[model samples]
Target chain A: MMPEKVTIADVARRANVSRQTVSNVLNSPDLVREETRERVRQAVEELGYRVNQAARRMRTGRSRLLAVRIEQTQDGMNVFDRFLHGLTESAAKAGYRVILYSADDDRSEIATFDDLLGAYEPDAFVLTGTHYGDVRTSWLAERGLAFVTFGRPWGMPEGGDHPWVDVDGAAGTAAATRHLLDAGHRRIGFIGWPEGSGVGDDRRSGWVRALGEDAEDSEAGVLERRTDGSAAEGEAAARELIAAGATALVCVSDSVALGAMQAGPVPVIGFDDTPVAAAIGLTSLSQPLSEAAVRCVRVLTRLLEDDSPDKPDHVLLRPSLVIRRTA
Target chain B: MMPEKVTIADVARRANVSRQTVSNVLNSPDLVREETRERVRQAVEELGYRVNQAARRMRTGRSRLLAVRIEQTQDGMNVFDRFLHGLTESAAKAGYRVILYSADDDRSEIATFDDLLGAYEPDAFVLTGTHYGDVRTSWLAERGLAFVTFGRPWGMPEGGDHPWVDVDGAAGTAAATRHLLDAGHRRIGFIGWPEGSGVGDDRRSGWVRALGEDAEDSEAGVLERRTDGSAAEGEAAARELIAAGATALVCVSDSVALGAMQAGPVPVIGFDDTPVAAAIGLTSLSQPLSEAAVRCVRVLTRLLEDDSPDKPDHVLLRPSLVIRRTA
Candidate 1:
């Protein structure tokens, strides 16, 4: 037989507190005194009291659901899935639920955001693949919604206090460059996205910083930025770099690195130590995406639960470089 | 300024039908006559009437939502993600919403299914990672739930009528074997999972069928079956096969193939041409996961909208072999 369902009233009676007080302790602990909150929590756990999700939702007028907005450009891209796994695992641990929202290219970002907000009224929002001057972020900020973005904010102030978690692209690239440099590679070529993009720029800066001004200015350390994020671009960049006598190439992404490898036998390194990177033995950086995703969810949930509008928290995580045969 | 909100009453009045009829036309077309449904649909498009999701949800006992049940064990695995992306995309195109329900291994599957069904009362359901003698499928069938699964029913009669979309695993493995044979590999090795599992056994059968009975029995064609699905197990199998004088190895999955590749320089082929397989240049049979997922959602949605329990439709997509350096 199934175990009997436990209710909050059981704990409230045991703790000698009103049902409302028990509710306050669970929903908004800030409203209750620390000692009272501790007593209620202990009683609840002791009684195995589970808050009735439906009743709680009705009382608070807020669903314990968070929205994860993903772009639906590519039909079968699994990159978002990896991040989602991390987010779901973390959210489950914290007793939160995730609802997926797909952003279509044809729809205005604001329209999409409004549709989701109106339909779900999600407690908090997590966004991915945001671009420069994204209206969605600004709108959420203006509405005082608790939210966090996975990518670095574009056009935002440097070191801006915004709730976000991203791969340390610059640092990862620097480590990649240092690895090649230590491997007796002086003529290292860089294949990256066009300048002015947040991730592309960050990775490019890391390469330049590691190489120094002398190498940056010299023909030995040429940087070729791709106009688009595609393997074809990487192949072209590799051909040019090879013609320019580059012994080693560092690509901005695993796909690009793979393309460069396919174009020629020149040893190449890539970012995002994606599954492909590991399979091909391409020396690359593995971003701690799952960890970052978990952290983002945790921080955002805390903000939503506390209703804290305090200074935003920004987290930076170090990405590890996996050495493969490519470089 | 945003356009004035269009109401359902306006559409109903314009179509000269009762508001409830209009609602039925939108939500359950099977309940409305074809002529009346066309008139209501035309009125809706004319007025640009988009359902006020929150308002409609409040008025109706049902939600315009469906739940995709995913096992927690397969959370980070990319294979599930590919199917999810396809399912989500197709569901969105049909103006339906999907919520993910993570199933806990510790909980009784029936209890978990009951909880989700009672809470969400979703219009339809999609189950992932279904196995032989799946109690959930039988229970759902008994309850007459509009549901679909990812694979053919195991422990059930052949040609069992069910709404499902499955990849041609046997044909895919045969193609992989033929590719290696065409590449001048006469002494080939086969590494697969234990013979009872549906997917693993199908792949192994295909490999055996591709190599005639005489060739299959010969010392040149070695077969190694591992009870566990792990890289270490695959590596061990590969080592044994290599010692037996095999030149090429075909694995049941990409992970197993990658593991076998790590054992030595023997050409390795895998199934499910996953992202990892693509990354490492492992020649594999690429299952049409996204298409299968989309089709599953489409079929399940049809089942929900159509009140009559029509004969189940089955879709089996042919898997394509991806040629890479490994083969």
Candidate 2:
């Protein structure tokens, strides 16, 4: 049989201190006198107090739990591994444990959410690789659950109140384009994801915005646009771009960049300085995944601690350019 | 209070079947009639009669648990992730769970082993990246515990009795060398980990064996050899090789290959077609990690079920070559 859960009141009684002192010791250790904190800590250890996590959460009206829901789609593959590494490292340092959950392909969006809610009852959720018209976000929002997503939600106002952290997709692409332009390459081509895909669309916008009329008129400028994020598709896109007379190519991802390099001899740049990009010497933008993960944990922890449902916070991280032999 | 564990007898009584029939349904479903199996399964579900895993293990002298220990060193980084993924996937497919334990440092090795033994009482242990004088392997052998290691133990005989599954490190290196040879490259150089490193030594031996003694001794044929696995170290190694007139480079890992690529225009080939390798298009040898994981589970399971220590089994899987542009 499970042992009885030790409570804050029990600890306070044992330490001959008020419950508020125990609370202060738990939430803000600095505020409590060192002697008082030590006494309470001793009492906690002696009484085997474990803070009754669920009960404490109920009283604070916030959970200490954070749920990261990862979609198992093909495009979502490989990205999660790096993300997981970053998230796990950051979360561990911040004293938060992330519960990983995957959405079943056969389950409806709401059903998936329901199952997760029942299983974990996390305080807040992090939705990675969110798509257009994502129902998961709306369901959580309606239930008044604090949450954040990696990408902007569909139909949400540009400056709307909802916490999110995403890469400046357009700015990253523009940086890549400017790098090529600075290299004296005028006939630069863009091999990117298909139109209507949120992140892809943002990347294309950056390229188009950078090149302006040069991007608009020539069929040669748009080398290949694929809806998929596979190596085979990237290779096909590279071949098409090379045939169209592109002296240099800007790929949507490092994987695509590798494929492009294998497909032809044309110089290429890629996004997301994945280890592969560094390995192959592909000039690309390296996303600060570790920093973003730390920030995500910080923000989520704050929301879980405080009961206010004020304006949501949005964080946009800068992508650094890594120059290599490919470009 | 925790609910009382439902026993096989209770399940059998509810399903109107003998306890032996219930045991057959749980252990070997094929032995029971389909209708009887269905009835027993339904009874199990209704009563929530989970097999008393700990008790069953103790009675049968089979924990059905596979324990893997990884070396805790900077060079051993990333080994755990791949190994865990493979082991977990294989264990789940075979209706078992893998209990993971890690040695934080050399001092914790014995403590880690003790904790794992007491807590899980694993059926078999898999030791990866073991070094000279590894006490863990010898301890398990002395205790008469079934076990395996990725590489042969340092003090053990070449064709020893202990079961092990290993990548043909020599053959993989030879294959990489042959790829460079077939590409009409004679002035090839080797960049690898330090001599004492078992994997490094094995791979370097293959490179030397493939090129012949006289060719390997030539100044142009021997570029640079480094001890570290960091990208910076790789870059420095590559620069040294380039200065020594080495045209093509073979590296110990994808990270080194990436580092070498970042340093200059030299084409690089590496071992382990990790995700990063795929992203960078570095020609690499892809170790059969998933296959080896499955095989480990299969072997461990067989050993657990057979309940005999008469003989040990050893398996070796050949690594495959993945050709990319770096070569």
Candidate 3:
């Protein structure tokens, strides 16, 4: 059995204030005098009065909940879990809660958005697993909804208005390539996803960019073998690359690297630095998720507060190389 | 620019009904005549009049959201993700959304519960990673708040009313031990956590029970080695078990099993069938997380609807043995 709910009237009577003053204390405390606010706050505490959620929402349209989508890839990387760990921790510290929603397709996602907005009124949204022609961006942008994406908006060029935070995959592989070059390995091949995939392409670009003078050796037609980014494929591709005279490899993901290592271990680097990589001592690039998450919260808070910068800024976080025995 | 919100007045005009009739259509359509209800609903769709959330909530007192906490263990496992995937999918299908919250300690969890209840009023909660002396059970119970736990209520015995759903860890290990026995392995060792942990102890029990006729041959004092459940410790334990003349090993977790496999491939079985196990061809027990998640949703929904079983029934789901090369 629940105890009878203590009301604003009860708090008002305890504090010798009007019901309106109590309402103001709960809603916009700034509008209440400091002395009155203190009195009302104490009354609320002494009475254990819970602010009526429905009434509070009607008065101030803030839900203080941030919605994020859950996505899983076939190969099963734990990047989303790590990102969420950071996202939830950071969002909580900034005084917001996270809500998760899943929809099968773009149309369902929009429907879910409409349902949530109409019902819960989440303060903003965070989109994950972003890809080219992600309808969510255009839909949210059209509605002027506050949101941030984990992936770079591949459809848009640099400096567009919508906020996004993506790990620089190109920079990560470039660092790996440069490291191999410094170690005196001339021929470094990149094993990545097929062409036209945004993140995969970005990672491959980093490898080519790092080659500079050795660009001819790193061309896609010659050294690059793009599979669906699996461990088996990584191993097969590594064998082909080794036969083709590549001395070192920079695979797109840890699973691929695991496969490459199995084929032959000739100084291979992987991305994501998953547990398997660490267990096997594979050097890989690690996304600074916690730092990026903190920045995401800051940007989202700014957006929520309507204190965003003059121009919408998209943030790109750098991935650091975790050098292990393999690299 | 924001689109103009469709008003009840517009819906009322479109439906050619009084504003009160339109309000009745949204809040308590059963009170209105069927013909009038259909007219109002059609108007609502045509005019796109979103029912005022605050008014609807005040009438129904249901947020249609379920709360769950996120906890990470020393060894990273994606069980939570699988569980959440099942949960969100099930809940969404049942017309509910999930809210994720993080709290480091019990006190903070209760504080968060109070905050969420006061602010958003989630319909119910799903508690994960429950442990001994979990105050959350009693705290939520005292408030008469609806909830379900993923782990069995450790302190409680059979016939408790508080709803809980736990994976049958003992059954999983027992199955592993039986499989080893059937494969002509007489001496099987168990690697588990130190005694007194509810889950670890339960897993150990399964191995001993399966040893039935030869239980003395696989006593904890001899064949069983308890560690902190680390891969390195698992490797060390496997060595000790091997020296003790154990032909096969049953591990409490995939991390420990991975280590055992590294020590020597003596046909090992692991639990949780994590990605590592699959990649390395280590046969492991896979928890039926999706099934558990569906049951959890069904139970929580029943609790929310006040249609729970006569006595709070704690459900235990079985884990399936995923056979691979290692076993």
Best by DockQ: 3
Per residue, candidate 2 scores C-alpha lDDT tens digits across B62-83 of: 5555665433323322444565
**How well is each residue in A1-327 modelled by candidate 2, as lDDT tens digits?**
222446688999999999999989988999999999999999977876655434443355343446664334232224455565566556545544454444454245466455445423456777787666666676677677778887766466553357788888888888888888788877777877876778888877777767763554345445556737677888888787777777888878876777788888888888877655655577988777767777777777777666754767778887878999998
- Angstrom error of the Cα, residue A280, model 1: value is 2.6
Report per-candidate DockQ.
0.24, 0.09, 0.55
Q: Residue by residue across B1-327, what tens digits does model 1's lDDT show?
A: 333556789999999999999999987899999999999999988887777654565455345566775444331224776667677777777777676666565246566566554444466778766667677777777776678888877667554456878888888877777777887787778898876788888778777777763354455334555647666788899999888878888889887887898889998988887777766667888888779977887787678666655679788898998889887
TM-score of chain B, candidates 1 onward in order: 0.83, 0.85, 0.90
- Could you give candidate 3's per-residue lDDT for residues A1-327 as a string of tens digits? 574567789999999999999989876899999999999999999888887767766767777889988775455555777778788889988878888888888888988888778767888999887787788887888888889988888867543458888899999999999999889988888899987889999999898888975654545447889998888899999999999888999999999998998878699999997766766678999988878788888889998886766666578999999999898
Q: Give residue B178's error in model 1 in angstroms.
A: 4.2
Q: Using DockQ, rank the candidates from best to worst.
A: 3, 1, 2
Task: Decide which is better by DockQ, 1 or 3.
Answer: 3
Per-residue lDDT for A199 in model 2? 85
Residue pairs of candidate 3 with colliding backbone atoms = none
Interface RMSD of each: 5.7, 10.6, 2.5
Between candidates 2 and 3, which one is better according to lDDT? 3
Docking class of 1: acceptable
What's the TM-score of every candidate structure? 0.79, 0.64, 0.93
Q: By lDDT, rank the candidates, best first.
A: 3, 1, 2
For candidate 3, report its TM-score: 0.93
Best by TM-score: 3
The docking category that best describes candidate 3 is medium
Which consecutive 10 residues in model 2 chain B have the weakest lDDT in total? B70-79
